[model samples]
Target: MIHVVFNEPDVTVINQAIELDENLKGDVVLIRDDYAVGPIQNLYLGEGREARKQWWSAVLAGGDYDGKADSGEVDDYKTVAELVGTMRRNPDEIIWIWAAQNKHDVSGYYWLLHFMKEFQGRVFILYLNNLPFINEKGQLFYPTWLSTIPPKEFLKAKKLARPITLSEFEVDPDEWIRLANEGKQVRILEGGKKLSQYGEEYYDEELKKFITGDWQKASKVINQFLSKARQTTGDAYLLWRLKKIVSGEGYDVQGEMKAMKDFEVKQKVGQPA
Candidate 1:
């Protein structure tokens, strides 16, 4: 058995749970990229390699957007392709997918389905986004990340995992293709339904207040804006938005807005307050 999960944190939590549960047996694989915010056209098609290359080129040009790579040499396309290779090698292994309802996890799930078409093994899913679980306080809550659930709760979820039916496989992949081509920031909810044009709800009105004066530091502006954010948005996404603002004359901030780890928004920034 093999368990496929999104992100490093999920891999850690699932591995820990599996170790404690003597009934569960499998190796864990992590899909380290966030598919929600990047280009997806032709990602599953024959031209996917070139398409991905172009997307990476743009991302690198837009300022440093290093994903959750252990080193500076991580290749998203190769990583996914390797997973496909693994499936081809062990066609009979039972593969379990643990995914949340967010675009990131849902998008990755669809990509996995696309790759698993040639696999001869059984596939099961533990979609936790909508599933309610009893927390430490004994209160039921819907968790957005697998890391949020305790090991005992995760074991329970594993027990309830079901095989992906043929009907689901047929319908869900088509929906995923449709959503992938739409090229919008969207959320994949229950039943493989897509809610398009998301993120507007999280737009902070206070962002405009930072545009005052001839120039302000982009780092300071981002800090100010995020301080009032209604939701927890990734620092990478916020920094990308700031770069777009600079490019569009929406604002001006100095210094090199590098990757998330080394990013620093310097002085002399201008934009609409």
Candidate 2:
């Protein structure tokens, strides 16, 4: 058995759960890309994948992100290819895809399901969509990310796993195709499997709300935005947007724009504080 998760933090938590429940023994594979952002046009094809890589480079442009552009990072295609190869060689191998209700997980699920169409019966989904779970506080709550759920609660989550239906194999790939063709930069989960796409600037206003006339570290502003916003994206992406806003007339910026910590931002003097 193989477990697939979208978020990196989910890996440690799932491993902890596995230690407690031997029945959940499996190798955990993480898909690295956040499909919710960037251009996903023709994502299944080689050229399309290269284009998205270039888009990520562009997004990381003018930022000091530890030289991600030059690292030649392995993508989801390679990871999925390896999984598909493993399943092909061993018919007994089953795949369990775990996702939570947030856009990041939901979008990753949509992107991955397209590749696993051939193994319909063997592939299963454990989507915690609006489902209540026990938190570390011993209180009931709905988790938006698998990492947020306590390790032991995953024992209960195991029962939610179910095979990807034949109908979904046929219909869901079409939805992914539609989303890819739309080529929008941001995708949001409306509910369930439904996703809505918007432009890159979708979160700009929200980021701006946290910025005030008083100058603050770009990182601080971004942290506040992440903590307070109804929905959030990665800090690197937010920094990119903040830089774009700085390039415009809306905000004043000081210091190098290479990284969040390297700069400071505030609203213009006459702008609302």
State every prediction's TM-score relative to the real structure: 0.76, 0.97
Candidate with top TM-score is 2
Give me the runs in candidate 2 sitting further than 4 Å from their true place: none
Residue 116's lDDT within candidate 2 is 90
Report the number of clashing residue pairs per model: 7, 0
lDDT of 2: 0.89
Q: Mind sharing the TM-score for model 2? A: 0.97
